[model samples]
Target: MTFSRGAVEEIAAALAASGLILRGGFSFGDDQVAPAGPSGAPAKSVLLVGQAGAAPWPHFQRWLGQQARDIANPLDTWSREVIGAVAQGRGARAVSPSDRPYLPFQQWAMRAEGLKPSPLGILMHPTYGLWHAYRGALLFEDEIPLPDAHVAIHLCDICVEKPCLKSCPVDAYSGQGFAHEACLGHVRGPRGEPCRSGGCLDRNACPFGTDYRYPPEVQAFHMAAFARL
Candidate 1:
């Protein structure tokens, strides 16, 4: 079954109210494990939901204010609540990046967006850069008509300086993959105040998509979460 353009627009509108955007989608191939639908059949399509930069900060802050002070995984909880509602209203299943037995969101994103990973391991979009995120996805039982796929262009290939790899104090990303312990240690230490207050120096060093960069507060929130985990 094909979903009409109006149906897609309606979903976009609903997500926009909460500062989320439909980040494109794709139909599951025969070889892929399409998530099970309500009737225990495989879902045919997936519409990715995400926010560009700090677009969802206000909406998230407002919702955060009303929740319990000791809530665990508040951001993920909020995402599930918001995306789950949209999914339920439209007769679809909701999945998140944080879900156990993870749904290969990174691979799915690259497929849907034609984006490639930067040295930092984040999907580097031509427009959003390192500042965007995938909150959740809506899975449908039928194939939904989607817009054309993005043309992949790896910006890092042409970059000369590659500032991102050099900016980290701990050399956490020294072209040898991320040093998780070193990163965690520094971010939680006193010397990490700069990163704690602003954000990852390496991430901020990226010159692409500067306009979509997240604000200091938003970055700080994510940094705090990272330090804890």
Candidate 2:
């Protein structure tokens, strides 16, 4: 059934009540427009969530699981949730994260749309810096009413020291951009030290997301996701 934006707002309110804060960014999941139907009209709507003081990780997982019971059998990941919501809205084949068409299509879309990669190679919110992460982005088949929000381009623009760049013991963050291999090496290498204790030094150094720092256990849970990769 097609849901009105007000209905969506209500649903979002409910989600927020559960400790998820809907955050606006320069883009959803790195500003990649989650494509919708076969015609590619763009997603009718997108849902973005942020954990409050702590990463309400379980609530998010449960939300998806509950959604599946009412909708498809399994709308597991962000991509799946996006696809299912869009399909429900459009009543046709929806976009799928695992659809194989999406991965490469994203790059092509970025090129076609002139969506430039952030100089940071990571989203630099005015508030949240590397400390924050995008856990998931959901596209809806039906447009969920939401206020227009400006996506944050550079969270560090005014800051002078830019500790995120300086904090890296290994110099993973280049002034111009990020060196992924360098970042992973320091985090994963047996020789890695500081990173083993807390988390990415450069990331932890960011002052934007200090208020939003995940609780220790929540932070640990997400850090493990990175470590596993």
Candidate 3:
């Protein structure tokens, strides 16, 4: 069950064929214990799979809708089914950001890709702007070779405009800090329809990767999730 570098790429390519990118990955030996798996077995290494922009939205949204018709927690079910299948086929364990006693996904992402946070707290991707996300990750019981880590440019540092700070109607985000209560109140108020129906105007204002912005439907979907309804 040992996985070679070639096998890693093969699994990555297979997931890519389904529109999921093997965003970045890391490896650790037995000396470096990984988080416990669902059965409480320790993981040896991990592969990070993610999506940039709306690459998987169309397919994922449709699948999620169908699952919602038949399941209670469609989002969780969809992620597990989609990502778990890949992990299972590769003889690896699957875990998510939402898993109880959550794994340090942000740290993992930083180590894997050298990502930095933007003003809005979303990771500023060099290519995807504010339009990317880490969907899930695959955990392996056996050690796997990691690809070379990248040194990504922190785009937010160079941008003087910082439009993300100005775009929110309620001034929810800024260099100072996020006004979480104000943001939630605004989104739940009478004037919140625009933000409720679309996504965060501040997030949409990030000029790094405008072309990768999520479609209206995808935007609305995430906005609703943020609203917790």
Every model's TM-score: 0.97, 0.61, 0.90
Report the Cα lDDT for candidate 2. Answer: 0.50
Candidate 3 global TM-score: 0.90
Candidate 3 structure lDDT: 0.80
lDDT of 2 by residue, 1-229 (tens): 4766565555456445545544432223426555663355555555444444554555655676655444432323643443344335333343333455544433432322223233345545545444443333454545444444533345455677777677776787785567777777767777665576566666676666688765555555444556656
Each model's Cα RMSD = 1.1, 7.2, 2.1
Query: Residue 199, candidate 3: how far off, in angstroms?
Result: 0.9
Model 1 per-residue lDDT at 57:
91
Specify the highest-TM-score model's number.
1
Q: Candidates ranked by lDDT, best first?
A: 1, 3, 2
**Clash number for model 2?**
8
1 versus 2: better lDDT goes to: 1
Scored against the true structure, residue 10 in model 2 reaches a CA lDDT of: 55
Compute the lDDT of residue 69 as modeled in candidate 1.
97
Best lDDT goes to which candidate? 1
The true-versus-predicted C-alpha distance at residue 160 of model 2, in Å, is 0.6
